[model samples]
Target: MSTAIVALCFSGPTLADDVSPELVAFARTQAAHIAARTDVIEHIIAQNTNHAHLTLEEISRLDVHWRQQYGSQDSPLIHRLMNTPLSDALRSLQLRSSELITEIIIMDNRGLNVAQSSVTSDYWQGDEAKWQQTFLLGPGAEHVGELGRDESTGSIQIQVSRTVTDHNGHPIGAVTVGVAPLQF
Candidate 1:
């Protein structure tokens, strides 16, 4: 990727002045790597078909269900997400990052969680800027969210998101990597 795209990844309102350039670059690299993976692309394409017909109300219901079962051991939805090979891959990435990465989440074209390294506050991310600024903006777009405390990791972090595209360069989904800047 060009330096300009990397710079753009960290630009805009969500870019915090206190965040380290090295850390931002690291996150951007991770995002791009994840986006290029064939498994990630294939999984998202499959999910897009599964979720294509879901209405807004159905998404809200699923989100509500996810929130209600957030910490419970009996959540089928969470189980399905966490048990996937993709989720395992994400978790492995997070573990290998030596805590620089707090979490990783892969969302489908509709922004519903396809796989996640950890349980998120909600299932649907379509309404969030991470999804909008990346997937909605088209391929190669990125969004670095403002620094905040990640509930799962309990670390102050920023979520760096990038659009996932297929071989045709069509937007398939988005991946968000939560990085703890203090780890830099």
Candidate 2:
């Protein structure tokens, strides 16, 4: 009988220039959990299916309203979406792994948000690095965004994204997860 051991590693924060082998290993392990969770992935896909029929006009209208109401202030969309069953469902799903997750955002194929765990700065994420990497790169590609500080919590985090795909492996949407590095 034989057993295999897997090792994990992570580079420290950009400014610190300190690399903790243990934290690196922890991050790698937590990253696995983030990537391999079927339930989380499925929730995102289910949301994509729910909004698959959305027209550009509808998204545009919401975007316009969001911008007008929130402008540079804290986004009110979170509260708006939270009132809906869709966001409620997502919030419930997120609660299952709240310890490891900082934020969750589900976006349609067009990069417009279908639902989110919290209010974001905008309704569209198409131009962001995370969306481009996950949605544009097609399925099987995971986008690991650069580590940054969460303005609200002031905690360092790394954003990760994966393309949402249909049973036939066609790209449908994308899901982004903000993870606190220390938790890993």
Predicted structure 1, TM vs. truth: 0.90
Question: In model 1, which regions exceed 4 Å deviation?
Answer: 1-15
Error of 2 at 36 (Å): 9.6
Scored by lDDT, the top model is: 1
Per-residue alpha-carbon lDDT of candidate 2 for residues 4-97, written as tens digits (9 for 90 to 100):
1111113333521132444444434443454344554565576567767878787777777776665445646646665666566556655665
Candidate lDDT (C-alpha), each: 0.87, 0.61
Clashes found in each candidate (C-alpha, N, C closer than 3 A):
0, 3
Give, for candidate 2, the lowest lDDT window spanning 10 residues. Answer: 1-10
Clashing pairs in 2: 8-25, 9-24, 10-24
Give the CA lDDT, 0 to 100, for residue 97 in model 1. Answer: 93
